[model samples]
Target chain A: MRVLCCVKRVPAPGAKINITADGQDVDTAHLGFAMSPHEECAVEEAVQLCERFDGEATVLTLGPPEAEEQLRYAASLGVQKAVLLSTDGSSWDPQRTASAIASAIETLEAADGPFDLILFGNESADSGGYQVGIRAAHALGRPIVNAIKGIEPDLDAGTATAKREIDGGFELYNLPMPAVMGVKEGLNLPRYPTMRGRLASKKIEVSVMQAEADEGGQTRVTLKQPAETVSNTVKLGNGPEAAPAIVDLFEELGLL
Target chain B: MADILVLAETEDGAVVPATLEALTAARQLDGDVHVLLCGDSVDADDAAERLGEYGASTVHVGESDLLNVFGPEAWGQALALAIEEISPDVVLASGTSKGNEVLAMAAARLDLPFVANCTELPSELADDDEVELTRVQWGGSLLEQSQLSAETRIVSIAHHALEAESAGGSAAATETIDMEIDDLYARTQVVGREMAEAGVTLATAPIVFGGGRAVGSAEAFAPLEECASLMGGRVGCSRAVTNNGWRPHRDQVGQTGTRIAPELYVASGISGAIQHWVGAMASKQILAINTDPEANMVVKADYFVEGDLHQVIPAVAEEIKKRKA
Candidate 1:
């Protein structure tokens, strides 16, 4: 039951996101890079599945050479294999990203047997286009389900049941093996890399694959940060003393 | 030159607000707006009647047995048929869970690029073929404007992105498209659903009373709940509350959680993070109660009461009781 999980290197943004000077991208000089939150969960889920099912787990990323840091980080958490589809670091449009990933999947599967499940973050932390995973799945001709919170594969039955959270309860989706799923955060709490595991990860070799992608139709115009929502706080008094004032405000609101 | 195709979703026998909002967004584009109505026993004429008021030019009624079940496979199959029968330049739907999934399914089947949660689209495509797009990224915290030069571009309009307005008067006519589905359409279907909250959801509540980590424990949420009900609102919590296991994820208000645009949001003990700010920003007014005078929620709120929530909350509740009595 081999599983493949995809992750992206994104800046760990602070409360306020700063746009580039030219407004073409996010300003990341002071920020640390981490895997997209959802993909972090995906990598964790893939490793857990391997622990439970007794199989190999591979973590892949399509980014610059520095992205190997994210790959190695996943390796620290028990991933047996790490593949870096190294790119030039500039943001690749969703189409090119999907094409390169699909081609890479085909190449890797040709050497080893196909994975039972392929995972992706529901959407990238930055671009959040919400289509790359589905596009990659389409290119591979596999059924893809996004926004999945829970997944359980029945190896004997060759089916995987996916749980998606909606406004109310969850929805169940059952698909066959060799399927792709877009996972969201909160699916599971990702574990930290242990001291022994961190030491082991440093010695592991990373396989870096060049990403050859054709320029897609979509080109990025300038990226502008939407204006900040301005708010001014009017003191409604303080502590127990503010109770009457709040009640008065509530009365003004007709709540009382 | 091509028509704008809208997948008009229906709930409780009426056009959902999101779909109506999508129709409004469609009006921004060039050419006539043709809506694809995918449902069983749907009143094509009736829907066309209401939607015509909102600017639907032609209603394509897609009736099929496969439409009866809510599955991406079947929904995608039905929509793919509509897309093939009428090749529209741009496709739009509401950015609800169902809307995004079904369009993604159809896009996958058609082998096209589908954009999700678009806030703005070009009124007209460029002569060079690149369709301009501005979509919400990281929930509403940021916007990304890009281009999709596909022969056909699929998009889902973000909820509440556009104010829905009636164009006043029905369009010309309705066309019926009967669909033929295969067994593979049943590969994945929704077996059942259980409503998380029977009534008063976080987003729909008139007044949203939220709590944070400072609220202490799950059992301690009782006073907040009582206050919320008294104010005719519902109880919501911050991600910290959810992470701390004091509240369910559904009651969370944050970038990834449900965005609430209520008339008022009364947040207690919440040091608002940017993620939570994005969700609460849409509220008409915000009031924060926190021990720290400079908490993010306090600074961003319209009203602030610096105090301990455990004491302040009960005090506020008791004050209301005394005032009413």
Candidate 2:
């Protein structure tokens, strides 16, 4: 069955992030970009499903024109097609973002047959709104499940068995076909692209579509740098010789 | 005052602390707070007693077989019915796991905007239907100030953001709402579970001993684990350790992983990346053991021991053992 995976280009996760001077956005002067870890796994899962089911994998992303770079990366790993929902570099509120994506999916399906499975990262690594996938699912009138860690497609039954992580174990959901899922990062270990694959990715043409996002009900006022927390760490000696001191430290905290 | 609706998450026979925290937040949005309690065979009196402590103006209890099993679709449907009848101006819940899913489901059912992981309440300066708020982005690493305008605002309160407090009042009115549970909603019910051993889990651990990429190997975690067990805590790791195949992803503590708030977080070999700091910053006390004193984790920690974790871990464990003996 054909699969569609949604990916987002986010600042590489790590280090303290600085807000831009305007306070309306993140300062990305020294930052690099990568697909969110969760979406990376979603792309990998979509590719794997295509490999097993003898279908094509289409990767879509909503970001600036530079997002084509992420689309190409996905193409390098065997994605058959790449679509860029190109927009202004500014972020969209979840309400508008979800509708824009739903519209794009409908436009794609009008030409191509419907996708059997659509995947989204559980949440964006940057904004982390945790609403777009569910909102899109609702807008498209499809059954959607979120926080999926494991998935088993029942081709015979025309259903998808999705497992979401809970506190102790997992909660399983049997969703009908043409389903949507919000997958987490640990769903799979993404495979690296080979030299030949990278070369093929360079030649793949990216289909760019302008995403006319409506001004939704939500608006970002400004970004605030979180208050810095200072910790005055008392050095408890050094090396293994400090082990006894460490024990004393634990005792002082009553953690013994 | 606007009428606020809170999805009360219950545990055992009482309400979860997070729900109380949600009620605490709801009280601020408006004093007219209503709570929707959904579950099977829920002890209404017990829940109402606890909820009343947090200034719940009304508790709407929805009991049904569909809610007997844990599923967001059915729960959200039930909550939707309650919302329609209660007609509250805003809906609130906690930000992780069940609370996140159920509110998202309800948002979809109603086709409304649902904001998740809110860290701060909005300013009352703009007196209108629209509310100005600040929410967590990058799992608390960054905060985004936003303005949300809707007939009904649905929000999922971020964990550890608001402290749960009681208004110190008696129980308010309790209303039993009629629930219409459909088979379609219950169609995707949970078939099974894999419950972990009782106690000492990362979320509720009193102390947490964590390692990072510098810890070297999976076997290297043995000493840290021993130290954690001795201290009645759990052993956690950074995403780097899981990436290096030295530890499982479940042991990771970061924005993308578990947000841990323990009595103390004793971390070694970790550089205290922003993502990890977001999760570990909630700890009451933090201690870092790293060779580089200038490391991010060391600089942020409340206590430090500059050394190789491989040598320091076992020595500390041995010292604890010796002291106990």
Candidate 3:
């Protein structure tokens, strides 16, 4: 019943993002990085599952050396071990990320045993690709569920019932063991690290895996910032009179 | 000619608006557009006629009793069958929760490149006929343009980002296909659904009045809800408000909750986080009512009213009543 949770480092929510001067990627000079919000939920879910099932939880992340901070944070949340697949600040698209994660999982399985469950946030709050979980499942040839809002494990039958949020409501599914799930927020409120936990997390070892070219060259093009529209301010009457003025404002912005 | 396939999402046997929008985009590719509808014994004639109005030249109907419940694996298998039949150049789906899951699995089964929440379409086809796309970044505050090298491009359109246009002609053609429902896979079933008791869904509400941490307490949200109802709308809340237990999770409007496309979005006491902005940015008009003149939403909004929600919301509601009279 061992579980693995994949986490990513991203710009903190609400951070004002700026494009680099070359227009190739986000400007990181003034940005503050933290664990992706949804990934925090994934880590929390993994920790809770391990606590309930009497197994170990391992946290994984693929980024530069700095990403070790996120892994350490997961360790503070009762994760037994941390694995960092370090890259040279290269953007590994979903496929490459999935391959690296699958490779690491295979290596870990060789040492210990296979993980019973793998958890991930629905998508990175930064890239918002929303493809890694499915790609990883494909690469590993396992059952996968995305944007799952709830899960009830049936340990006797070796199956899990999951509730996935749909457009207006939710859909239910039954999947066998050794499946991957991309969790959405509100699954649980992630716990904050205690003083003792923070002190112990600093002693945990982080193993860094070297990236292979084939598994690191998936990103085809770098991202560039979009053209910015100038901000304008207007004030109309508070009630019905404001409706026409709002329409006029939209028309002025060419959004009408 | 390379053709595109669109998985038209439907509920209660009717095509969703986002599906029509996807078809509208597909028609611009200058290739045959096929629409796939999977449901419980759906009428192919009626479904195909509606799909044809959205520029779907060919409508593939896959019906089975198993479709009474939405199973990703079963839907994935059904879509795999359709893809095997059409071998489309590209597959398009909406970025809704169900659409995202089904398409992700379908793309993986076919070993093709996949992208989600695309805001813009490819300007021109590549030499290999691969289509590039532009998608939002940083929680919709920015846009990123990129190209996929795969022959089969899988993309999901951002909901409400595109307009649904009528196909402007008679029904083109229709075909009925039989799909198998494996009883074994039916092990998982949705016994029932408990609809949210909220009067109006956040996504469809014409006016969304949202509360944030500044609202102070759960009891304070009643006035905001009253104001929303007075405006013929519904109530929404920021993540902070939901985190504080002032509102239900379903009422939270943000990246983690529901992305809304309303006619008017009123931010009451909300400071406007990027995640929150992503959900409400597509609203037709934004009105930020915050005491802080420098609130982030004030900058992005079409109009800013500098006042406390406690004072402003009541006044606005009263004015609406008076104006109507």
Candidate 4:
């Protein structure tokens, strides 16, 4: 099985996210970068699938040179190959990003055969457009599903079974091979890279290809931090003393 | 007035509350609201009647075997066809998983632009081809003022961004659309479903008791469970707790887990990282119990109690039981 997983580099924000003075980007001076949480799980899933099927797992990202860091991180997690769809480090709209990634996939598939499966984060941690994977799948003429938390690919049968999480339970879907899925975070518990794996990842040569696509109709005017939720926090009491007050407040809210 | 189309979703043969929220948002755009209700799971006639009361002037019902179950491509194709027939200036849907998926598919099929999780739209959106709007980023931690330059604007209203209220309008006229289902539409049809045991879910519970890593071990969640059970609520956890294997992912309250809107969220020992904050921000009230006074949850919550949850939670649970007696 040949699987490709798409990842994005986003700031790993802690308590709060601060914007740049221009409001065009996030302030990264004191921040660390990590792969989007869902895509990290996708990478883990692809690696496990390859391990089970004895195949290759490739990780790709569409971002600037710094995004190579994310691709290398994927390599450390057992991805055998890495590709960088190099961009100018500017944010692209969902349509443009999808178009560029689809084109990149086409170029890569031309060299090697088509990937049996392609996985993407259900949504990016930052922009959260919720469309890039679907649009890219449409462009590749592949069937796609979103919010998938489980996948079982049958190579001999050329089919893949996927499970999507709903409010109370899950819905299962079956798709032909060469399918796509927007995976959610709980697909798997991502494994941390071993010391040996990290050393090996440094030697994995990332293929950098310049991304080409026209800007889509959606444009970002600026970014603004949401107004902080103003709360006149009422301190009820300390320790066990707070319990009676909590019950009283619960009664006030009609929870009793 | 501009012609606006809303893709309505249904559950248990009635309109979903989020769709009504979308309709309320649509009314703000100053348009004649038309609804597209598709699927056998929904009673199209009943949905039309309810949607009409929400200011929907027309309801276009489409039914097909492929649409009997949730299939993204089928719904997307149906929406694309409906758009062609209605020729609306704007299209809206609830920012649900299915809602966003279908709209994305439709946008791809038609090669148009679509935006998701919009919290606000400019009042002059109907008149302008290129309009600026505010949408949530980082799961509502940040907001983006975006520009959409599309002939037919397609967007989804953020969940719970607007209250769902009826406009008390006239009954809507019904129109039926022929859903042309093809073999490809069934490629990803939902073939099986598994339901969780009936109880208050984290997303729907009136009160949620959330524990963090400070709860220590898996066994430490017992008091939280007891409190939730006594209060007729549900127990949730932060990502840290889930990552530590103290709870399941389904019980996690955070950006990647579940976004809840409980009336009261009792956050115990959770520090309220941006990821967890986004999920719990919609709660009507929050009571934070933590040892640190400067903890994010404590600072942001409506009420705070400074203490170790180990002692505080059991006491709270005991108090609830005493009150019941």
Candidate 5:
């Protein structure tokens, strides 16, 4: 089995994000970056699946050149290869990103072999669009599942069972091969890179693909800052006295 | 005449709350409301009755063997087929994981413009129908309004963004439509299903007890669990807590995990990042407990306690116990 896990480098979840002074996009100069938390599970699942199924795991990313840092990180986690769709970091629209990723996957298939499985995080931690994986699956004409919490791959039967999170709990699903699966967090705890693994990863080569515009550049009418609500700060005591005040506050807020 | 198509999500043979909310929003339009139901032997009589009550004049049932196991491609194809059959003016679905995925593919395959997590309706509907929509941006701190041009409007409504209300009426007449099953395309099969750890879902919990990096360790989260249990609620965590392996990802409350709308949300040791706030901001009352007087959570909180979580949590738990006693 050949597994392809799509990874994205996003701003760290805890960072206080601010739109640049230009008011067009997020200010990235001071923000730290890492693999999207959900995508980490995808990469981890891909590595585990390959380990169990006796196959190779290839990590793919579509972003600016800095995204290569995440690809290298995936390599450090024992991913056999890394593919980067390096763009100029301007167009991060979901549809355009999906199209570019689909093209990159097609190129890889033409060079290597058809991938048996593709994995993606449910959504990017930064943009949280939650559309690219399914759109890519559609563009590639493949089956897909989103927000999968658990996966059971059956190599002999050439089918996979996935448990997806629904409104309440989850529903069981079975899908066939050459499918796309979007992994949510808690699917598996991603492993940290070992010293030996990191040394080996430093020697791995990364393939960078040229950027191309998606079908017809999807129009981005305007990018503006969202409205901010005023912060209402209230302080309370730490003991039993706080409870009534809390209740009174809830009553005032119409929460009780 | 233009018709709006709403995809009604069903779980375990029951219609989901968000689906009703979507149908309610769909009724605001001046076109016929058409609903699509997919499942293995969906009780069309019951579903159509509910859809009709929610203002759907026509319920289109797409029955397939593959419906038992959700095949995104197959479902998208089925929906695309339904769209062709109905020629809808708009296609709407709840922004649940599955709803967003299937509709995105359906929109992409049809080459139609699409938007996600829409909080408000577009200001205008014209030939181009470039609708302006509000979506949570900058980690829920800001709502960005943008426009999209498409002949057929496609959008996914953010769950909990709208309230769910029943439309009082008898069940509409049932109609069954046999959808073509592409077993070849449906290569994936569901082998089985397993439940997550037993607890009230954070999204629906009335009171959410949450922790952050300040909790220190997984063991320290025991107090939160106790508080949640005492309140008959559920426990939630910020991304930092989950990242540190202090809690399972399912318990994470944020943009990437599960957006929650609780009556009272209590944050312990959390510094309130924008993404985290965006998820829980819908809560009616927010209480933040942290030693840091200037924590972002303290600033946003309705009630702030400037004390160590280690001290505040046990004290609060004891107080709840005393109150119950």
Candidate 6:
């Protein structure tokens, strides 16, 4: 089984997100970078699947050159190969991103074999378009589902069982090999990179390929912050003394 | 006027509240609101009546064996065919998990651009070839204004962004359509389900007792659990709690976790980071209990108590118990 995972490098936002002066991008001066939480789980799941199934897992990313850091991070987590679909630090529309990623997958498959399974984050943390995986699945002519939290591959049967979380339970889907999935966070707790793994990650070779695709129809005009509503909190009391006031308020609200 | 079509989501034979919200959004475009209902389990006549009250002028029902079970491709194919037959200027749906998935599938099939989780749409979108729209990003913490250029504009209204108001109109006329669902679409259909114990879940709970990193450890959540149970609610945790392994990720409340809308959310020891704040902002009322008087959660909450949750939660629970006795 050959597994492939796609990841995106996003700003590691703390407390609040600051916008650049041009309003075209997130201000990166004071922020760090990391993959979305969902993508981190996807990378972990891919590595785990390969480890169990006796195969290699390749990590691919469509991002700027700095995204090599993310690819190397995947490497530190036991991913066997790293490929960077280099961009020019501009955000690509979901459609264009999917197209470029599908092209890159095809190029990679031509050299090796087809990936038995491919994974994507449910949606990017920043844009949250929620369509790239679906579009890419369509382009690849493979069945796909989003918001998957659990996966079990039956190598002998050449099938995979996926679990999606709903309000009150789980929805299970079975897909044939060569399927794609848009996995969410909580699929697994990703492992931390060890010191030895960090040194190994630096030695891993990263294949850089240009992301060439036409712009999609949806174009960004600007980014704006929602107006914050400053709350006038009524301080009930302090410590245990506040407990009675809290209960009274709850009673007033009819929660009693 | 823009002719708008809304994809109605139904549950247990009735239209979901979010779909009504979508209908409300559609009416804002100053167009005749048409709806598409797909599912054999849905009571089309009853759903049409409810949707009509929300300003749906027509309800197009598509029922097929393929749609009897949830399949994104089959539903998307039905929606794509409906768009072709109806020739509406714009298509709309609630920004739900399934709603966005099916619409993205339909958009992919039609090779058109789709904008999901839109908070605002231009009134004159039908008259223009390209128009600017505002969409929710970062799970509602930020908004992105974008220009959408497409022959048929497709969008989904962000959940809870607008109120579901009744227009008090007559019932919509129902028309059944031939849903030509491909057998291949069944490959991706839901095969089975493992239902959780039915009760007050985190999403539907009226009261949510939320704990953050300050809760210390997993065992420390016992106080919160007892309080939530006493209040007939559920216990939720912040992303930090889950990340620290003090709680399961399913119990997390944040942009990456569950987006909860409760009558009251008691957030304890939470700093109210942007990611977490967006998810909790929908609560009707918030009471923050943190040691830091200037914590983000405390400042933004409707009520605050400057104290440790360890002492305050137990004290609150004891007060409720004594009152009950």
Best by lDDT: 4
- TM-score, candidate 4, is 0.98
What DockQ would candidate 6 receive versus the native complex?
A: 0.83
What would the per-residue lDDT of candidate 4 be over residues A1-256, giving only the tens digit for each residue? 9999999999999999999999999999999999998998899999999999999999999999999999989999899999999989998999999999999999999999999999999999999999999999999999999999989988889999999999899999999989999999888878889998898799999999999999999999999988888888999999988899999989999999
Candidate 2 lDDT, tens digit per residue, B1-325?
A: 6778899876445677899888888877644889998865467887788888898978888878777666667887888888788877888898866788788888778877777888866635113568877889888878988888878788888977889998996986788877888877665667666566777678779899999888888987899989988888999988778767677667889876778989889899999997788778889888899999999888888889889999989998889989999
Superposed on all Cα atoms, model 1 deviates from the true structure by an RMSD in Å of 2.7
Q: List the residue pairs that clash in candidate 2.
A: A233-B302
Clashing pairs in 3: none
Model 4: how far residue B6 lies from native, Å: 0.8
Task: Name the lDDT of candidate 6.
Answer: 0.90
C-alpha TM-score for every candidate:
0.91, 0.95, 0.89, 0.98, 0.91, 0.98
Query: Candidate 3 local accuracy as lDDT?
Result: 0.76
In model 1, the runs with Cα more than 4 Å from the true position are B11-14, B39-41, B126-128, B180-182, B213-223, B229-232
Off by over 4 Å in 2: B11-14, B39-41, B123-127
Scored by CA lDDT, what does every candidate get?
0.82, 0.84, 0.76, 0.91, 0.78, 0.90
Q: What would the per-residue lDDT of candidate 5 be over residues B1-325, giving only the tens digit for each residue?
A: 5688888777667777789988877766676778888765458888888888888888888878776556666777778878887778789988877688778878877877677777755535312466677765544554556566677878887777788666675666655568886776555444456666766788888889999888899999998899888877789999778878888888899876778888889998889887688888888878898888788788878778777878777767776676557
State model 5's lDDT: 0.78
Q: What docking class should model 5 receive?
A: acceptable
Chain A agreement with the truth for model 5, given as TM-score: 0.88
Every candidate's TM-score, chain A alone: 0.95, 0.96, 0.86, 0.98, 0.88, 0.98
Q: Score the docking of each candidate (DockQ).
A: 0.51, 0.65, 0.35, 0.83, 0.46, 0.83
Task: Specify the CAPRI tier of model 3.
Answer: acceptable
Question: Candidate 4's residue-wise lDDT over B28-79, tens digit each?
Answer: 8888889988866876667777899998999998867888777898889889
Error of 6 at B252 (Å): 0.6
DockQ ranking from best to worst?
A: 4, 6, 2, 1, 5, 3
